[model samples]
Target: MRTHSHPPGHPHDDAHVGHGHSHGHGTDARRLGIALGITATFMVVEVIGGLVSGSLALLSDAGHMASDVAALALSLFAVRLARRPATPERTYGFHRVEILAAFVNAAALLLLTLWILWEAYTRLAEPSEVQGGVTLAVAVAGLVANLVSAAVLHGGQRDSLNVRGAFLHVLGDLLGSVGAIVASLLVLGTGWTVADAAVSALIGLLILRSAWALLLDSLNVLLEGAPRGLDVRAVRTTLGGVPGVRGVHDLHVWAITAGQPVLTAHVEVAGGADSAEVLVRARQVLRERHGLRHVTLQPGAEGQPCEQREDLHT
Candidate 1:
């Protein structure tokens, strides 16, 4: 509606927040940063314990924790970077940095899962003696730590991808820790060291499931796909229904940052119209009806509208 001139070089996020101040995103980033620091410190403690305990489950859990530390660190870094103003060289600012980091964190976990499977395969070929009691204790401690980290991040992750990545990292650690504990009990009470490797393999399967989804989501963002939850058809219909708008085209929706969605489109009206007024109305509709803020629309198309060739192929 009303155009407020930002300081000339200020970076803008066309993602979820629209043209409003990025203060909310900044505040959320700070919270995730604090949670990550806490998570990283405890992760180190768990890794050392796993190594000393001589338990593969504990070690596996520690591996997961190690990844969690890396994920959290990336998220923390992303939050800070996302706040930096945009330059002509990088106009969108650093919002998508969080998404890139998310992809890295997830890919790292998937690679680690493959490594775990390979290790489990080797162990299956030649089973080793495990210190089950020690493994159990370490696993318990790791579980407690993971639970704490998950709790700290739970609130924000639903709204922020940086926090969600960190949360997923902690959740994966929790799964590994629990598997380690069960394997330790089976080994100590029933003399089933093979169960340890079996459990690790199962945990690897779970990680694969998670990693596939993360990779796909991250790739979608990189491809500039429409933001996950937005409906393009609905958006087009809504725009066309506007009083002064006869058609809408060239509409695009994508992430400018992890949790931000940006939209750009063209509107065509049948008669002469005011671009400013149409822009104002379009902005209002996106924000109020669609929960979208980062929208750029050019009004007035007297004749034919834009068409997506991809649609014709379908």
Candidate 2:
């Protein structure tokens, strides 16, 4: 017998797969809008400040802030798209759009960082005059703006990869602002204009670190990899241990998005065991022990060969 279980009101409904995530969509959209506004407003200021101060650190931070604006806007659009209801053709709705957005944002950040590093290297080779006093004043202002933007996105980032990508961009800008300030101080105190190029290079490296992590996480989701921290072998072992179950096979687990995991498996029942009872026990174990609410199971007598192709077995 083949059986499937999902939360009440949505049988085999991919739309309702992640119940925990539904409640936060509205709040997440609101937060993204707020952060987007803050980031867009400051990006212009940073650009003009970079030109006036002639500081590579300031220009690099301004470049990062520009990318932040684009990242925040994309993240906001993804969050809204993800809220759309599922369709017959697109059973999972637009949830994957958020993952795609994160991937794009991470790639853009990586490219921008490389550009900043290259510019910094050139500036270091041939030092440029930077107005320390002006750079200091503008960098301090940028620091304040980035702090507010980072604070706005921090709450939602833990729950959504889309939000986390935007948060990382804002956080990178925050660090860049700090680096610009430090470089400005070094130039003012010791007349070492090279400090600006050095600081810009450091900021680029920091951005590379955060962007790489976001890229890998979003890529994992896009590839339908198992949810992070979930152990497929452990899940198989636990399911096999269920009372009346003779064995487990052809088991599979993968995520639809960051927090939603779906599982399917074939279970062999012991001789003379009730298949219905075995199915119920298996469902209970997966739900209680593994926190899996979306599941499908096929149960048969121990001696029966699985009808599925052997190559499909994991």
Candidate 3:
């Protein structure tokens, strides 16, 4: 029985360089800063407008924008913290900080949504006299601010879960702004004060949707679940089909962050086959087919005793 274990700094390590390292977050940080400024400025405006206009919708939007400010600020801090050098105690550096921030932002959004719904119910019971003119003007201004903030975050949103959480927050705010506008118009045309509470309820629903999605994604990563697209069964089948491979077992695939995936597996090679070639083929398949660059492959010849049996998990 021939058994081999690959070291972290093996000769083939270059094929999967930058395992846990992320680069070029400086641009993301700057973008987040700009978005943060826009959101904070509008948040103050909306708070004042909500107070003077007595519009529950406007106040709800302001509350969401306040959360957006926190989300963006946390995202920016995460990007900077992720750049710190890796340490012996924390080999993966602070990359997971961004994910943790995302989880926190999602939780905050959920809580805010619940509060908005409760407030909407109370407002519906005893409607307030909202100023249509002031509500309309303020909602329009908020809409513009939210649009700009969304544009600033859209690009980075696809690249990082942290940014995605922040983007979702801003998007929820944009929807809230739209709802506030519609409610204000309805109040102006028909004097239906109930429109304000109705809009706030709808905005809360939208926030709940986005918050649920972000929460699930962040929890999946934190729990070390397989990435969204990659199936563990398919991966094992693919590895088993590799030339000179007898079978595969103890396969694992998971994400370290939003875009980085890591894999580890034990492969059984045909007797007398070149284990080195099998190892290379496995790595290549993982990299090219699964988009997995960070991989650790252990090869064992047919009928060989599995030395890593105790450590292997399905």
Candidate 4:
């Protein structure tokens, strides 16, 4: 879907939401589906393997993978929901479902990381004798699966934050696999059981690092903060340069979904200029120059302030 592309003078409307783009939502869903499948399969194996091998780290990692399965499943459903037409009662067509999904995914990751850290702490306190070879074998399998998952998602990371978030999960898993491998080598060579526990701690830290970023990004989008790539001052500057536009205020920029940006503003213009023409030019500048399609431009007298500010302060 093309973005709002409406120039200055137009008010925010469903048009921006309606006309937004769907940058490869289908491919993204497919890749995530495959990744989730692999993760789920390995999660079961790792759980059983951890239990048999007596490795707390393996068990914790498996638990996190289970959550990943749920995340990917929800993301798949959200993507499909986003594509559906909005009903009479539900305009905006469930696009933000992905945003909600991102939030949940991030929160889940944090919780999972905390749990892993707890497990790591306990393991640190009492490093137990675990079958490092067995844990290593399972981890190797998980690594291959994670690599496959990452490959499937690599193509879409540039398009969707949702997709990028999923990719990060797999990437973390890959690193966890490496940590597991190292622990196994240490145990095999020197019977250092603490190495296994230490590696788990490292894995938890890595997972937590990625999770934090996702949490903030998802929250920002949900809060309707400007999209990550958006520049508020630059947007204001550009709008101010539009002919017939004297100044700008009440400017708002946000995302409806991945790669879809919307803007709304009050533009001070010549008292008698044609509102429509000024709006068209502003819309063109936003869309053609900056990739913002959803635009709302409110016209005002050259020296007047936005009616909103006046109303709010009065």
**Model 4, clash count?**
7
Q: How much RMSD separates candidate 4 from the native structure?
A: 4.8
In candidate 2, position 89 carries an lDDT of 98
Tens-place lDDT digits, model 1, residues 189-255: 9998898889999999998887778777887888899878889888878877776777777788887
Weakest 10 consecutive residues, lDDT, candidate 1? Answer: 305-314
Cα lDDT tens digits for candidate 3, 262-309: 888778879888777677777777667777777777777786766733
Q: What does the lDDT read for residue 162 in candidate 2?
A: 91
Decide which is better by lDDT, 2 or 4.
2
Candidate 4 segments exceeding 4 Å error:
1-20, 303-314
Clashing pairs in 3: none
Q: Which residue pairs collide, candidate 4?
A: 1-21, 3-293, 4-293, 4-294, 5-293, 7-283, 9-297
| lDDT scores in order | 0.74, 0.85, 0.85, 0.78
Return the lDDT, model 4, position 77: 83
Count clashes in each candidate, considering only residues at least 3 apart in sequence or on different chains: 8, 0, 0, 7
Q: What is the clash tally of candidate 2?
A: 0
Cα-based lDDT at residue 268, candidate 3: 83
Better structure of 1 and 4 per lDDT: 4
lDDT of 4 by residue, 186-290 (tens): 888999899888888898898888889988988888898899977888888888898888778778898877677778787877777765677778777887778
For model 2, residues 1-314, the per-residue Cα lDDT tens digits are 33334434435434345454666778888888998888788888888988998988888888888888899899989988888878899987788999999999999999999999999999999999999999999899999988998888999998789999999999999999999999999999999999999999998999899999999999999998888888999999999999898888888898777777788887888999877667766777887888786676777678788784121111
Question: Model 1 RMSD to the real structure?
Answer: 5.6
